[model samples]
Each structure stands twice: as structure tokens, then as C-alpha cells.
Target chain A: MATIEELNKDYSKENNILKKLTSPGGLKDKITQFQADLDLAVKDFKEKKKKKEYALSRNDRATADMLEKDLETIRKNVLDLRDKIQKASDFLANQQKIVDEKFEELSKDPEIKQKLDSILYKKYDRKKKAELNKKQQLETIKQIVDAHPNIQKWLKGIEGYEKSIRKCDKIIDKYKATPPSTPEEQKDLSDAIDEKNHSTKSLADRRSDLVDYFAKNHPEIDKNILENIHSYGNIDRQIAGCEKSINNYDKAMDNLSVAKDTNVVNQTSPSSLAPVPAQKPSWFHPIQRLKYSINEWRARRTQNIEPNPIEPNASAKSTFLEDVKLSKDEYNSEIVQKYLNEQYQENLHKVARQKGNDSNERGE
Target chain B: MENDFINITNEDLEKLSLEELADLKIELDDLVSKVNDMLKTCDDILNKDN
Candidate 1:
């Protein structure tokens, strides 16, 4: 039978083991997670193939383009996962190195382990709690969004209109071969023809943009458009509550009012459409304040000189060109071919001169 | 002479003709199938032991 003190000591050891095991630099860890996103991409590709084979020129092509965008998203997710893992590992290594150096420094003090024992490993636990809360909030917010009638109506409207666009493509392909018949048919044809004209950057292009946005690099874009795209369901909520209603206060309008007053998303990042700067992190690092300020000292001493890029040599330029439409062999051989042509012409001129000299000798 | 797997770059893959992607696609599919088979075998063993 263990005493309360003994139980506490046992539990502490167990927690320590878990901490060590899950630590960023541990032999076994959860910090470096391999993503299943590429597998999802493969599944998307397979599903797209099936749709292509069966759907022919059906309205499903729009859906197929969306699926391709989904594949791109999955690819970007895998890349992001890898990048995060690499960054975590690098940070862990740097911290461990600093700790090792500090440990050596602290060895002279003789009470280093006692000091280290006071520190608790609770950051991952806090991160987990935050994640759980965010997920719960996202679900709660999503329900609020789904309850909006306009959003539901708008989503439903998309498929029917998108179907019209796809039908237009098929009809244009067919109608071009055979002329228009009825007056209604002619009108439909005209609309489809217009959709076909400027529709290259249509729904699919916007979808691809979304995939790129939630992607690995997450390149910057027009915030308004990104917000509109991401908040597809949210927009529906806004419209149903505030702008679209019969009374002085619409449901869409009411939601929009709440949105303006409150920071809707705890809005943790710069990517947030509506930003609250109080919670914002500093753009530069802070730890330099506590330390000897290496950056400040270096800034005073060092010149702001940029390193020069290597200039390409004539031979290397001919041998290895970046994004050259022509191949290395073709470009090199073309130059050689030109030189040969010039040399051949020179030889012909020399031969004619010699013949004239021989003719003069014969005349003498 | 043996070649390491990492010798190929993304640019090389991009430059490959459709015929080349088709050839690599076959190889990638085979590798993916083998990986799936191995995963299933390991899962079965673990399940039985557990």
C-alpha cells in the first residue's frame, strides 16, 4: 500500500516519461507527424477518373473540377505538414543545443538539476486544450451559419446555375454542329454562348484559388475574395439574418451587426479578415531583450551588404539554360552548325583564289 | 552503376513527357500497392497479438 506522497512521486515519474517520449527531439514523438493528405489526393484522383469516364459531357464536369481543386488542397496539406515537422525539429535542436551550453555553464553552480526540476512541461497540454476549444467553437459557429435560410438557398442555387453553365458547354459543342431550332432554344443557346466566352476563370478557377489559399505556402491574395470564398456558409448566415429580410431588421443584417461588434474568430493570425491588434504577436523576436542583444551589437558593427549571385559563363549558358524551350543538345549543336557553315564558306573562297593564282601562272 | 532514388528533381518530373509520366505512374502504382500490402500484413499481426 503506497502512501499519498509515494503515489504523487509515482505519478510524477509517469508524467515525466510521457513528456520525454513526446518531446520534440525524442526517439519516439507525436510532434513529427507524417500526413495522410497525399493518400487523400490519390483518392480524389481516382474518383475524378471515374467521373470522367461515366459523366461524358454531363453537368458533373463542374464537380470534377472542384475535385481536382480538392486534390491540390490535399497536396498542399502534405507539404504544410512536412514543413511544420521540419520547423519543429529545427527549433527543438536549437533549444537543446542552447540548453546543453547552459547546462555546462550551470555545472559550476552545482545545483543545476535542482533548478531544472522546478520546470514543468505543460505547453503541449495547453496547445491541446486550445485546439479542443477551437474545434468546439468552429462547430458551434457552423451550426449558427447552417441555421440561416439564405445560405442554404444560395448553396442550393449554385448547383442548378452551375448545371446551366455545364449544359451550356455541352449544348455549344452540339449546337455548333447542328443549328438552333426553337426560339427558347435560341435564347438558351445565346446565354450558354455568353457563359462559354468569359467562363474560363469561372467557378473552378475560384475553387482552385481556395485550394491555393489553405495551401502550404498560403500566398497572399485579395482578402475580400478569400473571406467570401472561405465564408460560403457564413455569408448565407449573414444574408438570412441581415440584408435580405422583409422588416427593418433582416436576419442576415442582424448577424452582420453582431459580426461588426465582435471579433468573430478569436482571429489569432494576420490572415484574419477583421483584425484585433491587442492579441497580435510582434513581427520581430523578443528574447533579445533578456539576452546581451547580439543583433543590436552586430547592427552597429556590420555593413548592410547583399551577397552577389553567380554570373553564368558563356559555355554553361549554352550547356545549361533555365526554362529554355530548346534542349541543351539543340542549342549547343546549333551554335556549332553556324560556326561550321562560316568555316566552309571561307574554305570555298580560298580554293577559288588558288585556282585564279594557278590560272595566272599558266598565262605567264 | 546504381542510381540513388533522390537523384530526380521536381523540375525533371515537370519536364518529363506524358509518355514518361505514364511510365513512372505504373512504377508508383506498383510501389503504392506494395506499401498497402505491407501495411495490411503489419496490421494483421498487431491485431492478432493484441
Candidate 2:
């Protein structure tokens, strides 16, 4: 067994690993801790159970309710913890599960078992080596910037978007004070705001620095692609990009005579909106037609009983019983008697003949 | 056994942070599980002798 100091040291090392890995996103540790707590709760539940069983045996109601309340709280906390941990795990990288494996071994081992200790130490040592260097961070920051060009145009678009957005907000506040906007009105407002704003997100303060080159230098791209590369700083360009299709639609809307005007303005096709008929499940009324003809053909061919139509069993039954039945009558009655008698007589005759020959030789 | 647990529960454990609570919970859970397991093992040893 390891000394108390040794055990404490192992525990401390595990704690340090956990502390460093503790990001708010990762619930791997939190859930592990919850599971540990849940187990204690189960133990407490068991203890409470023991008490309840004893009390019930003695007919004590008040004590049981008190224990039951404690148990209820524990159960609620356990359930809540499970939900929280699942949500947290979704957000975090699964790095904490590794830390948990080491923690479990170190905490559980009374003797500090050799294999577990070695695995725990190896994990600890590897983590110590992985501390990210300065050059790596700079490269990562650079890559983040270089990846998105639209991000620069986005930032410049922000100030331009601010005016329309503020107008939309004022409209929203007015709507809130009144009976509220209709769904169509709301959608129009949101779509109008979102069309420009969603693209401009790339230019927001923290991210804006990356795409500044678009706003800082160049009227557009290098002309190979011949695409108009606009700055995020230029929200006018962004509004125009969103408006281009809308402007075309508006022109189309205006060009329409009275009969065609609604179609152009609405832009949605009515034919595709109709729902298709639902097909009933096969089990409800087994389909009339066979999916494959091979099974039907084979059934027509064979003299033997038809194969069961249901899905094949995982394990087929053996033919050994049928084989045993076929062989039973022939081997049971006459054959055993004949075989035993013939063997006994042959041995008996040989022994008697040998004895008689020995006596005759002695007499001569 | 109830009294023993009552004493443990009353030992200022409620005031601790969730992380500290988890640590204490793991320790306690380990102890209880060990005891339950030990009880089963003792029963098995006695049965084996018979």
C-alpha cells in the first residue's frame, strides 16, 4: 500500500490535471463529479432505505418521509445534473474524458496498482508537453483572418447598417407598445435587417481587423476572377448587393399588369404548396404484390415444406434430433444383442482352445 | 448507521462548492460501495466454507 503522502500526491496530481482542463464548455468533469455525487446519493438512498425498511418494520412514518424528502432532493439534483452535463458536453471538446480516466484510477487504487499508475503518469506527462507556444497562436490568428474576405466588407457595412437597424428597433419598440406587428410585417422587418447584417458580422470589432485590407487597400479584387470585391466598411455596397435581386424583383413587380402583378410580387409558387397523399404502412395491410419473384419461384419448384416467409432467425435450429430419431430404431433392438454375443463367444472359444492345447502339450 | 450518516451530513459539507462537494461525494460513494461489496464478499466466503 502507498503511504498517505503518496496517495495525497497522486490525488493532488489528478486535481491539477482537472483544474487546468476546466473550461466552462466542458461538463465532462462536472458530470463525472455528478456521477460520483449520484453514487453517494445512491448510497445515501440505500442507507435511507435501510432506515426506512427498519422504520417500516417498526411502523415509523415520520422518519421515512424525512428520509424520502432527502432522497427526492438527491434524485432531482442527479437528474438536473445529467441534463446540465449533457448540454455542457455538447459545447466542449471531449478532452475531459481522458482526465476522468486518470482520476478514476488514481482515486480508486488503495495499493496504487502498477498498470493504472503507469497509465495515469503517462497521461500527466504528455499534457505537460502540450503547452501551446507563441508562434502557434500567431499563425492561428493569421489563418482565421485569411480565411474570410467577406468579413472585411462586413465591418464597413456595420455603420451603414446601424441607421436602418435603429429605425427597425424604433419600429419594434412602437409595435411592442401597441398591439404588436403582424407576422408578415415582422418577417419583412427581420428579413430586411438580416439581409445586410448577417453578411456584416465578419467586420465586427474583434473580427474586423482581419478584413481591414479590403477596406484599407484596393477598389476591388485583382481582376482575374473579375468579381467586384467590396469593403465591409462600405455598407452601401452591401445594401446594394442585397437590393440587386430585390431591385430586379421590384422592377419585375412594377412591369406586371393587374392580372400578373400578385404573382410577381408574392414570388411564391402555389402549385408546390399542395400536400401529397400519405401511403399507409405495409404491416397495416400486407402489400398485394410480391417485392421479389425468386421466393415464389423457389416455392413452386421444391417438394419440401415451404420456407418460413418471416425474416431469418439469428440462429438456425440443428438437424441432430431428426438424425437421432432416424437412427434410433435400427440400432436399439437386434444389433446390440448380436454384436455382444458374437464377441463373447469368439473370446470364450479362443480361451478354451488355448487351455486344451496347453494340457495336451504337458501330457506329451 | 443512520446516526453515523447524520453525523457525516451535519459536518459542514453543505457549505462546500460544487467541485469540493463532488470530491467529497466521490470519496463517500467509494466508501459505501466498498462496504456494500465487502458485505457481499463476506457472505460469499461463509457460503464457500459450507
- By TM-score, the best candidate is 1
In candidate 2, which residue pairs get closer than 3 Å at backbone N, Cα or C atoms, i.e. clash?
Answer: A152-A232, A153-A231, A153-A232, A154-A232, A155-A203, A156-A232, A156-A233, A157-A232
Q: What is the C-alpha lDDT of each candidate?
A: 0.41, 0.40
Candidate 1 Cα errors over 4 Å, as ranges: A1-50, A53-120, A152-364, B1-50
Say which docking band candidate 1 falls in.
incorrect
iRMS of each prediction: 22.4, 17.4
lDDT of 2 by residue, A14-84 (tens): 44432433434222344344443444444455566678678878788988788767766655654554554
**lDDT accuracy of residue A234 in candidate 1:** 37
State in Å the error of residue A29, model 2.
Answer: 5.0
What is the Cα-based lDDT of residue A146 in candidate 2?
56
Q: Cα RMSD to native, each candidate?
A: 31.4, 36.6
